[model samples]
Target: MDVNLQFWSTEGKSFFQRFLHWADILDPTVLLNSNKKIEKSRLLLQTNAQTLQEPLQDKKVKEAWKLSLSSVHPGTGEIIPLVFRPPAFLPLATPLLFASLLPHRGAKQAIIWQAFPYFVMTQHKLSGPMQTFFKRILPIPLLACLSVFNVMIVRGTEYENGIEVMDKNGKVIGVSQKAGLKAVQETALSRAALFGTAVIIPESLLYFLYRTNFLLRNPHALTPLRLVMTVSALGAMLPVSFSVFPQLGEIKRDDLEKEILSSTEETELFYNRGV
Candidate 1:
């Protein structure tokens, strides 16, 4: 049976959803940072628990508040460098207490709120390297294999069942239904010559784009997009290779599983730790 593959639409999703999805992935750190900051503030509150000293003026508080959390966080494997400074909010009223004030720059609010509950309520637990590498990298490679497909030319006059042919008028040409019983050798080659020839350009272009974004902002978006492109390249190439020699398409999940399972414990604990 012939199966058709579809891909993620170029059509975009709402910005908030994308932002939140990234937040979902990144929330552990954000939450950790936020809660740590709140705790710092609360301690400051408890110690200097006096009423606000003449409404909070832009007058600089202590140089800056810094907290360095040294434990490994989950999911992304990152160390949380939790830092907090008093919010730079435009104070409307005189500062009675620092706790009474709010930050002027509220852009971090959603990030803070999303992470706060998680920080307060939960402990992050994530997979070790063997599990992680397989869970993360395996799907990406598989995904890449699925995303791009290719057609190929075969040497023999008798066509294979899965092969597709096109005529000059954009009509699909069918191979002869007749099959010979004698075993025949097949030599398969790529249908899209240009794709095979210039694969490096696309791969390099994606890398350049990713690096440029990394240099500029290094935001969450750049990382995933880079992953998408990287996987896209792999995906694009795998099928093309398969089309050229269909036997190359065969991937043994059993072998892959064994390899991943074997290395479960010796993997670096910190590599599995989130930064």
Candidate 2:
């Protein structure tokens, strides 16, 4: 039994290493940096060959390094910077904007409505189990509502100007009157459903695991283990959520305005249904 356990552990480690290597290949930043490294190496080799007879001076070597760093690849003709900024806050921007647009009473009511669930969950008087239960369940509904609101705000903004209609060749023909609103409604419903599914599945699994004492078995490792479990759950759910709906939304040409249909020969059209 001990030998079997050791073999399984070794296999698990190998599996994780392979998974990380595959993830690295799929990572955009890593791929970009790798290409940059290859380009820099080639440039250094060419520079070294040219200066082989008379070794480069210290200043010239420094200059060459700087030039290699700054030089863009001939293929892409663009230099990727070393620093990267993640757009983590982009998802929150829409919700904040939606809240800002409401009247004073409406905004106050919205804030209170959203905050009430959190307040109840965090109340000091509540028992630990009750608090944990609320914490797990409340986020599902709250997130679903917020997702719907975000979709409304986005679609409302697009409705003001209308969405661009394109021809079969991908050329913009004209704007459709209510096509944007319809697309937004469909996307919003789909997203809300997906959000609920994604949140509920993980929360349910975690709740069960917690009840079984699977997560609390190792007191010293609890925090890191929970974090890893959470990340793994999200990673597993993302692909399933994305697969739930078709990203390219289809609309009948007849649903569009007369002018738009006349401009395009196709009876059906497709547009990116925003996530």
Candidate 3:
């Protein structure tokens, strides 16, 4: 990020030193100061102009200084260019833009469909008092499933407290429970648990609020109120899944060690159960 130059010359040491001093002020991108004759002659003019108030000698010294500053070395012309941009800009951006268009739409619809079945099944074949009662209570079971998904279990060695998350540089970024379970099962359950909980919790509250006429109604056309509440509730969950947890993060350092110690003792008792 920072650049500097080193000047070398064969003139009398004092004169060459003065030229190097002047060259230091120019802030050249490359090093080039091998001409001792030019150095001494320019140094003399520069020294003379510093003491004089006349414009003509000042102009002459300025020209000499410009010539000295402009010279470039053919041998040491290694220009280290400024690299200010990231290398992966295009590759990263293209996928993200395309993802926003096609894949994201399908993924979002599938997520909604998966969650819809839980909601619809819970509300199945019930009406009036029964429908209202199940709506109020079904979200609790969904929450229990979610609590299990959020629950982190550790079951490995050389992994801290059964958790191991590392970066590309072999540095531990954090602890992870993902490795403890089969990858496919963990991912599928994690998604199902989260989506189920997300849809249930807010929908239950909104359903009651809608039935009781607690939410404000749009004036002119008179919307179905429940439809409006459902849409709003669904919109609210997006921020919870994407923004809320990500922004409010937790970092646990000694946590893994404790979990590992506990899991070790717990596992020993299990294997010794029959014996």
Model 1 over residues 130-218: C-alpha lDDT tens digits? 44443223433332222223112222333243222222222323322121101122222232332232234344564576666763675
Better of 1 and 3 by TM-score: 3
Q: Judged by TM-score, which candidate is best?
A: 2
Q: What is the C-alpha RMSD of each candidate to the true structure, in Å?
A: 28.9, 15.4, 23.3
**Number of the top-ranking candidate, with lDDT as the measure:** 2
Clashes of each: 15, 0, 2
Model 3 spans > 4 angstroms off: 1-131, 143-163, 166-170, 173-228, 246-251, 258-275
Residue range 153-182, candidate 3, lDDT tens digits: 322231233334332222334344433233
lDDT tens per residue, model 2, 1-275: 11111112232234343243223222333333455564664456354644333323455543333333223322133444433211111233324423422223322354543455556644655667776555456656777777788778866866677776655444566776576777677767766775566556645665677788876785665545444444454444433433343434457888888888778778877554434
Decide which is better by lDDT, 1 or 3: 3
lDDT of 1: 0.27
Order of the predicted models by lDDT, top scorer first: 2, 3, 1
Worst 10 residues of 1 by lDDT: 2-11
